[model samples]
Target: MSRLLSLSFFVLGALAQGTSPSYDYIIAGAGPAGIIVAERLAEAGVSVLLLERGNASTYASGGRSLVPWNITLTQYDVPGVRHYIKNSFADKSEYCTDTPGNAGCILGGGTMVNQLAYIPPQNVDFDDKWPVGWKWTDVASAAERVHSLNPGSTNPSADGVHYDQTSYNAFANFFSAQGYTSVDAISEPNSKHDVYSHAPYNVKNGLVAGPVMTYLPMAQAMSNFKLQLHTKVIRAVRNGSTVTGVEVEVDGQRQIISLNNGGRVILASGVFSTPRILFNSGIGPNEQLQIVAGSKATTNVTLPASSDWINLPVGQGIKDHIIVTLNFNTTESVDFLDTSYFIKPSSNITDPYSHGNGILTQGYQRFTFWTSNTTSDGSVRYFQGTCYASGQNYVSMKLYLTHGLTSSGALGITAAGNTVYTVDPYLNTAEDKYAIASFIDNLLVQTRKADSTLIYSGPSTDTGASLSKVYTGGSHWVATAKMGTDDGRVNNGTSVVDLNLKVYGTDNLFVVDASMHPDLPTGNLQATVQVAAEAAAVKILALPKQQSLSSSSSSSSSATSSISTSSSSTSQLSSVSTTSSTSAQLSSSASSTLVTLTTSASTSSTSSSTSSTSSTNTAQATNPTCPKSDGTTFTAKSGAVFLVECYVDRVGHDIAYVDVPTNRIADCVNKCDALPGCVDISMSGTACYMKGVVGEKIVNSKYIRGARRIS
Candidate 1:
């Protein structure tokens, strides 16, 4: 068969397929991190496929509002209703199982169900837990971008007033009187040592707006961007250390999702699922793989041989804030509301959205972060407190022992493929125990001095045994797939990924979520996780492009030549001279004939030549019916068809396009094929353009024509 006919068959085969659709990048989750990275890459004109285990959040889709606000909203959009998504309606399919705490399985991941605390991590959080290249200074720019895009408002009501300031004012007074600096938490994000501030949330106009409202909309607007919901990624399909694609089950039907040439896969499936996916793919410690390998269900598909497994400590380094709650009665001056109001949204709920002076806009009215006395290791221990109305006329203070805790834990998979923390993170060390106890005692003393009218109703002494019973993971879990320079596969290192967030043994696989954190930060992790993803996108874009199998020298170049000929009809001249070996030459007389050329190690030259054929012969060989290109006539490939538009004057008509410095008609076609939704291409001088949409098709010779395969 002729090369033109072969090219035609390739196009038809691609369009006829229903199961496999390739993309340049495949992201496994649609959380804040995943959505941010996807948007950035898609903005840069790379095709992306984002898969989410849950459907779109009700907030974006406009679900029913229990309270009549004259505006459409869902539980996800309201700050007061946020707790209902996880606490009241949690057992619904949107939540994950086998984890000690709840993790959202929806499109926004944890952001969909989290309390929306938008505090950025302190500088010490990065400098202490992150790798060398991931220090605060290195990530400052990304941090700034995240904060700028989603700066949660302390007072989100339309009205300029704060809702129930009774609890907040009391705590502020107490903390301030105790010598702790009072500042805007978000404004002084780095100063978490001894500060009390009103809690900052991603809520805007009384709505829980986050990445779902920002990055996702931009990505969804791009033609080359696609999202598949309710798809569960089981494992990655790999050959040796290179991942070709992922195996996912959509609606109970299993399918293989392939990647385009030189493509990448980013795992942003949270701290638990990210590691579990790696383990299922046989990319974890040997002991864990052995457990997975023994399960028929897990090993039902292709399993890597023992020696072929990438043995990194994937499930190690698990950490979470240790939380302990204390209840206290507020003075007569302070008023409170109970959780019942959240269930039955009162008529006053609209106050925040309409006037910005209601209780619905805030989670916990006040929050505090402070340090305890230095520990034996010379590290300053940290603690966080948030005071909110727990019930009628009663306030609850949830204290989180955040920083300088040396206790680490482990996550393991069950026979059913559920991720669970085999070793919980708690006060495992004597120093950690002492820190928690002393910290609680000091807080009690301060509260007694600051507000003698208040009455305490919790444990007086922090007996290690009593505290252990009450202490649990703060639900701010992190560090399952740690990132560091140390290779976990050797030298007793425990890190799973490198500083670049790439899996230790793979080239194209990366972890861009909380799973890559070396340790937990001192504040809510949502902001830091987002900043890390932004930084990861920058690093991934800077890395050298991965070479595709077709780009190899061993592949036949005849198809490429045929595609090039159909798009640009230069002369069928003899061999072109080069710095190295010369490419095979075509006979001058072989005008309409198909020819095969052998691979050559030659540097491209900028020389041109034409065949000495008669005008009639030239016209016959190079069909004038084809799109005009620089006075050169070209023949359309037999099976390939394009919608040609000429004299088009519109600029920036395409949603996204790739620019090649040195134009090659064949290279441009290949690039378009690799990108999803690529419909047209144009070449002008040395500039080659790949466009998503073509506005007009005029009959001007100045424009080169291209078309998307429809058959």
Candidate 2:
């Protein structure tokens, strides 16, 4: 069939009745990550199939959840509509019913249903938990690609205005009084410690612009790309360790879609659904496989024989951010937005909604802040807080225990073919409970100290046990199929996927979504999922394609990719050019001007703690001829190619400092190259500082920073 006709069939949901179409790549789940992988692979001149269990969400994607007055826009188009959809519109169709927890089942997945917040992951998010080759330095450029493709705005109004600032104004003042530094978070992603910033929403021209609005259209425009909606992938069609295709259910009819020779299959069905797929495919733990094997009533589909089962820890290590809500009475006259505006668009041209410049353009949360607490065990755990106006005099703060938490849960598939949480991932550990309780207690004390007028009349004094009972998950689920150096098939190994994101003991069967995230990120997970998909695409494309399997292999040993060369494996994917520049570090025309303001609060009594800031004044380069602030590639005299940025100094992870007496930039690069663990360098005057990892980046014109590019 012609490409156009084929695409039309797929787009119109004209189910392929009996026959299976061959494709070079078949991706399960059309979430932000799935669509991104589909687009990237299609762009590489490969035939791709992207399957979505849910239908289109955005109006542009044929969504019809429109407000009465607006025929051109759907409910998903508006940013603030997220507040209403979760319990209303989303429950009927957008939310996954098969999973016990909340998860988006629409075309864009979480990005389509979420609050549209576009907070990117901090460097420590990857540096701390991710395995080698998936670190901040390796995936930084991939993150930048996602950021460039989907630009965000703190103020999303078409008129370049912040529509509802009452809540933001009040909270910004409150956080400032608590000694939190004000920052444009997108510009300074590393400023997670004791910092507050305007909430960044991913929208364009007053409409939701996520993977559905950005990458999906690009994929649809390509002849090689086909999107099949209303198609639920049951499981991978596994032949020994090789995944030949996927068995899916369309309109209650089961079908097996085969892959082309040497093709690949990627599971992006999300944290819960992906593991379910693995379990159904006989690739999970023995206990889960046994349940599936005997579940003739729940799962009608025939399962692979017990002898072919590949035991791996697919549903282990599930994690979600624990959220604690605190209500405060503010003296500031904060007006609670009329949520009716979301369901009914104003017909009057004079109204801001007509111009897409009203409160409807903003998300529920006006401002977001980050804080950290050192637990009694001497380990630091980070927490993120978002403030939103709950009522005229009432403001609600949601405190999320984000990265560095040591709590985990398990996921399991029931005999009834439903995915359920085997264990809750809340404050399961005493350390996590203590950390959250202490953090809240400290925050309450600070709030009282900062503004005595702010009345707290919500929950009573929260002890660790009480807080644990009251806390709900942030719904940022991740790490079901974790990526790590250790193979899950091996004894004492904890990872389901390897560094290349390929599932252990399976050839050409990979996971590219939150299911593979080793840990939860610092903020919302959509942006991080897209970045990971981008990085995974680059790695998957660079690897040599596997030949068609003629006969199934008898060996049940772990399947390892040839992508890694050594223990570090940073430069192993040399076939794919890797750059060090990150989305957080990009200086773009669309970049918002950072308005950093110092609060009037005295810091004399504040704790001398570690923050995500760099002291650039003490590390200034005295040489007057320092390179300009333009992002340029510089080659060292010793033949090391580095991506150099002037006026940029990396934060933390200082290896050592060497004095380049000649005060030359080349000398600094050479010095960094000579160091054993140096991956980047920051030079000021004659002092060259070598860094093992690129942490948070602070703007400083006095120094030149170079991140070695792996070509």
Candidate 3:
């Protein structure tokens, strides 16, 4: 075994890229890739270390900005709630919220903060865009594996949108009339195709559910798995010629953790964070590191030599979906965009969440995604816009720019404590803006054909417009770390990893996030990322020990490099990774719900109609507030810090809601706030929704299945 790696056994090491004495595998970042990778290794009986920077999202429910408020029509815009939204991500770019992007600070990562749509990319996309050995079938199998772990429902509404179908059909038909196709299911994204499915939501029955609730928990159950939450991996530690482990922080204390060379280290951090972490570890270009060493950050930092920068590309190719919104008033019955959704100046924050699910309910979330046939590569994205606040409404049509021409962006740190990520994701090529404008024009024309009312006569031709402005960027970012056959170029490059997702230089490190995409997909990135991660996990598990043969120097997994290594460490690590994460949990299913009941299936008498009577009346409550499965009141008065409202078959039970008092909600919200395991939480009513913790103790309530409240 490498001496440096061996030192990790007992040394109080804190270096970024030096080898430690021991550990089988070390995973960085806690999103889907990290979770699934850790789960697979732990299941296999390998000793694994899962490092996450964000706090665990196990207590509260849904949005952090909304957590401080109560959930009801009365306290909709409570002063604190409004202030919370205003102060949310205050340090981030104003457009971070203006455009819709999910950059969460939780254990589950983006999976926690996302809109929760589920999807996969077209089989041909992988087959065509990727290099040899990367086939659509392979990725499809991986996607199947992922879905098995985190399956979504085909049906969202119980009775299937009685009054809501009209709006959807109208919106879809209008587009179909102009050559668009109406798909009932979400399709695997294709750069040149269009299809639909019910938006594959991470949420089922109005609950947030994702990987942490599924893969990570199963891995956690394994004694071999050691999870380190709130541990931020600053950089990779290395010896003269061999890679070692990572330097991380826990509770403000820095520690150097090691993984034997025969042991594998995977960089599963997200696109934005992954490359940044790698660069900090001295895996990036020399020119960049020289600048870092000169900064105040260099005092405590120990950077590796420039040769460690490996010539292959890493975080250069960035891609994503760019959304172009069009707003219009429908002639037929339409979800009131300005009324229930966008709030007025006079509206108090008291009645935050409206009762009796409004248009935002009724499957108003029903939207479609398609990739254009354009030869140029652009992105579908949004800059925080008017419709993106804690109280903003009006769902905009997202124009996904699947295959943009631009390559990777610079992943570096700012003089400030925060990481500064700058990418010409769009306008990276002469054809960039043209492709976007062209696609938007096509989408507007087609969608207008679907429903003439979905229009917003732009006062300005600029694309960045939000509900308040035009010509703003969309939030569907992807392709920061691309997958390809060869290292294409310097600035504009081919990719960093292979079609099989093996990083160029490394032995076992693989990338499976949106950044690994050579080009953007046909639709939203979550579905495609789903397919990619699933495929990567399966392929990784199928390979034998040291299976990688084509690995280059960039991926951190090369075997021929000038470095001392040991197969014994690898073997020892293997001993801890023999079991699969979901083996015991998958006794037919990972989660067992109480047979979800639709409104039509209900034999019990519960009022299904909405009343004109105001919620402030608090008059004549109908449906009995059934006791929580524990036969306890789930409301604030009951003293429960967290309440499980909606549940998905995420793990052992279903996705749950966490309801607590406004005073104590933040603490409870912090508990589950940003983790992918949380689905949704309602305030004012003082309830937090929690996912992934549903247990066998649950009792199914016919419950308010739709967005409507349980009056």
Candidate 4:
């Protein structure tokens, strides 16, 4: 192994100086990417530090709560209460103030605030936009892992039946009559054209569930994982093209967090904030960095000199789904469910948890995927139709134009050091405008054919030109730090990260979030972002060991003195280091170990493993030592027999159900065994559905069937 002593001295000196804590890996932003990466790294026995700009979304803070059928849960946990994040009650501290965008800053990031729409990106979404080593095949296992950890459900209600289907029935009947195929969107995730499906959400038993309910908990359970909430990262402490640590402010106290020798820093702070941090660190376009350096607002901090800057395209090729809403008035007979009813507590506020049934459980939105044939180039531009109950006796149909749209924007920093979208990515291209017009016209025709009573609202007669004026981003921003083979810093290219998601000019710095997406997907981005993080974890684990730099001189120049040097002393003395004095003083507070690195990148294909604490760690039924039958028997505490394909219905009018939050099949069986007269149980995605009796035999591929012991 190539051991460079200079780097080790820098780390040791930082620790000796006593400025801030040190970690093997420091991940920015506690979003999907950050949580997943932290979990994986911790599982590998590597020390990880995850930083978030917002506080925890716990039930005690009224940010997340669940009261079942009676009253809605907190704004962060309930599906119906999600609109509060975008309304007047929106917490400014938890959102980005630079632009009109809505990027979550909380512990779970967007997962805590979004509508929980969960759908995998189509194969084409990856095959078209991503470069080599990041195609659909590369991320397929990651997608499966995410689904297995936080599976989406078409029937999220405890009763296994969809509730308040007035809007759904209207849209489904209309679309089905017009030759649209109806399928379970979660089961068939890639079927994106001429198909209508229930809104597949990442909600389990009435709560907004995803990384917040799964990955975050598992990572927190590990001793090596550390989290810092309500902390803001200013910039990276870098020397030339290398980053050694980060400068942060926690509770108004400035500190410098140093990395271990040959340590790495992962930036998963979404698109806007990720680029903003890089720009502040003098790692963006020369002109953009000049703007920051010349700004009076940035004068308080010692900005890097122009000679030390690592000029790259930090913020470019930004993209978002363009949205257009179509409103319709429902008939007197068609009863519309009031989604805003959850804004205030209901009369049944004290009702017991009903396993996610009632209005608060579901997102109350039905979706339709359609493909447009009006494009002259024949590119695969698609549209997403989200019909939801809104206003008084009205249903609003939102049409989101996505996939194959060529419009893009750019992000830059202002003189005040705030991030801004200098160029918005809404209908900026001729092709996208044509596609939107064609999609709207065709959608209007379909609606008329489906239900004549449904009236048209604004933009009824206008073409794509007029609609462009009212279009808004779908809040699915991506590609600011775009990843590709082309280097944006040279040859008029436009990619910031290389194929491995490493910044073009840096070795140890990586971006594993939506910011690295080369293009937007056909559906929601949370699933794909998790997939990217999963793949990144494996790629990072496979890299060769990083060589540390060592030197005898105690000066900033000594940090990168020479590449050829050997030092046997593990404890070397160095008074001076490459980073500032603040970094040296902060490093003494924490201790970290050097992580083992693979000698070479692994050439094996990636596969999903369910051994993590958040997943079901069950032995495969094919094991010869295990009992073999049509059902997979498990070791349950209450002597339960697990049948592979059985279910129960009609507890309370076939509605009342209980879901125990446990990943182990055996533990789930034990919960069912403990229940009185609980004859049947169905388990899937960290939830156990218990029943009073086996009313009828129902086959469901998604769930594992279990039965209680008669003895």
Taking all chains together, each candidate's TM-score versus the true structure is: 0.73, 0.75, 0.61, 0.74
**lDDT by residue for model 1 over 355-431, one digit each (tens)?**
33466666654555554568888987778877776655567777877767788888888777788777776777788
* Segments in model 3 whose C-alpha atoms lie over 4 Å from true places: 1-22, 58-102, 158-170, 187-198, 296-299, 307-309, 337-364, 369-371, 374-395, 404-409, 421-423, 442-451, 460-474, 487-494, 498-510, 542-711
Q: Per-candidate RMSD vs. true structure?
A: 17.6, 15.0, 19.3, 15.2
* Candidate 2 lDDT over residue span 1-711, tens digit each: 121222243354334322336777899999989988887676554667889999777655767675444454567876767778756553368889889688888888888767777888899999998978888987875665576556577877777888677888888877777788888877788888999988888776566777776566555544556788888999999888888899999899988899887889999999889998999999888998888888977678566777888888887889999899887888778878666755554444215654556666777889899988787788779989888888987788889999999999899989888888888777888899888888777667755554554557555555445655688888899999999988888886889988878888887899999999998888888889989998888778666756742111111111221110001111111111112223212112221111111111111222332122222211223222223222445555455566655546666587776655444555676677777777787653234678888667743322234444332
Q: Rank the candidates by lDDT, best first.
A: 2, 1, 4, 3
lDDT of 4 by residue, 512-555 (tens): 88998988888878888888887777677556645642111112
Top lDDT: which candidate number? 2
Model 1 segments more than 4 A misplaced: 1-20, 61-71, 298-301, 351-357, 447-451, 459-465, 549-711
In model 2, state the lDDT of residue 555: 15
- Which of the numbered candidates is closest to the native, going by highest TM-score? 2
Q: lDDT for model 1, please.
A: 0.63
lDDT of 3 by residue, 1-711 (tens): 221222231122123223324567788877777777676555444566777776555221111222322221111112112222223423221112211234655566766555555555556556656666566644543554455445554343333443234445445545555565645443333423444344445533222445654455445434445666567777777664345778887777778886654566677777776766655666554555555556645335566766565545555555554445555444545443333232232223122112212222122245454534445333332211112211122234544444433433455554332345555454555455566556566545543454464444444453432221233334455655677766533554557776556666655556666667665554445656666665565556455554222111112221111111111111111112112232311112122211111112111222332212222211122211211211111222222233333211122222544433221333333435445554323221123344444333221222211111121
Decide which is better by TM-score, 3 or 4: 4
- For model 4, what is the alpha-carbon lDDT of residue 700? 19
lDDT of each: 0.63, 0.70, 0.44, 0.63
lDDT of 4 at 117: 80
Candidate scoring better on TM-score of 2 and 3: 2
